[model samples]
Target: MNLYVRSANGYRVASVDEVVSAAKRAINRKYRRGQAFTSPKVVEDYLRVKLSYEDNEKFVALWLDGRHRLIAYEELFQGTIDGTSVYPRVVVQKAIAHNAAAVIVAHPHPSGVAEPSAADENITRRLKQALELVDIRLLDHIVVGKQCVSLAARGLL
Candidate 1:
């Protein structure tokens, strides 16, 4: 399927093909540079482009192993805007199911502000603690918008 993005800036058509292309470009750039992704926006951008063709509200989590490297990235949930929910227990369960050693969670702010809200902070703290109990590190909680913020880099996680 093809994806479309509409904003005050304008409308643009993005297909799954384009998304994969963009992600590959991003990954190659990072790999060539020998650096880890430093921002959540980068990851979000990859997912957004990759999933742009789909029609649903989705949240994705990127699971990492002990070395802070990507083990897997998957969509954790999907629903309409008014009533989507995320449970910490489910998150922990998924992490355990994946045998993830660490995690960097991310969700998009369609409104385009990367600021972490009080609720967002609280959730991150709760998830971090939960994961810690199982020896799975919460490496970061990233808020993606037109920009992105890393709670770990900001010392919030």
Candidate 2:
């Protein structure tokens, strides 16, 4: 399927990839380094743009500064349709490399539900402990799907 947008050109057509790419670029530009990372709405918008159409499981991390400003966003792991393995060691390594003071991690479910699994909670616990050793805060773990859920908001963190 394709999309058509009416502009000065009567009808301008765009592919899904083009639209998504444009959206991503717009998002990056709108949410620069100085933008606050404290809003759930903002985080959800960013995560949706990053993982909305993924079919396989993906793990991503957002490195933030002391004031929760964005430092880096990267995909750390990609897994099969059902699951991904996230290593705290690798997450800590990258956070240290980025000189991050805090982190927000997220993953999307191909199954279209944002509920955190037992495994998700377990990883969050392990990650929190690992990051604590280096003094980096684990701000939240967001599970994205048809809806986005924050483990922190649920008192899981």
Candidate 3:
């Protein structure tokens, strides 16, 4: 639940949120720009670190080059606790701007549920179809909650 982290003064107890933030910073430092993402675990860990539980929904995307190297990471949408709007046009535009050849999209559930709902599947379908027109690959759509569920792994994408 809670852990201790070293600080300038001494070791101090850090909340889950603080630990997640620190992990995210460390990951960002460790995996600099242009590093290829070769493993799905890295994506899962990065998502867990970046999008912890909150009262609202936040949709994020990881932009990757043709070789699966990192280009940029962004939180594109925010909404209430239950649902959020995902615009495929926005995702397409941003991918074009980054010149990304692939993308991994994810969002956290405030209720701490990792199951991909029907809407999630529909959006994934639309996103895949939209991105295909531009020759951009949709790597996966992950649902982050108590645990991560990958739609790609489930053959839903």
Best by lDDT: 2
Query: Which pairs in model 2 have colliding backbones?
Result: none
| lDDT (Cα, tens digit) per residue for candidate 2, span 42-118 | 89999998888789999999999999999888899999999999999999999999999999999999899989999
TM-score of each: 0.67, 0.90, 0.90
Tens-place lDDT digits, model 3, residues 1-157: 5599888999889987787777778989977789888888888888877776567988999999989999988999998998999999999999999999999999998899889999999999999999999999999999999899999999987
What is the TM-score ranking, best to worst?
A: 3, 2, 1
lDDT of 1 by residue, 37-117 (tens): 455655555545544343444556777766556667778877563224667898999999988887777666655666877
In terms of TM-score, which candidate is strongest? 3
Q: How does residue 122 of candidate 1 score in lDDT? A: 86
lDDT of 2 at 117: 98
> Model-by-model lDDT, in order?
0.69, 0.92, 0.90
The 10-residue segment of model 1 with minimum total lDDT is: 28-37
How much does candidate 3 score in TM-score?
0.90
| Model 1: per-residue Cα lDDT at residue 62 | 75
Regions of model 3 farther than 4 Å from truth: 5-11
**What TM-score number comes out for model 1?**
0.67
CA RMSD of each candidate after superposition: 7.4, 2.7, 2.0
Cα deviation of 113, candidate 2, in Å: 1.0
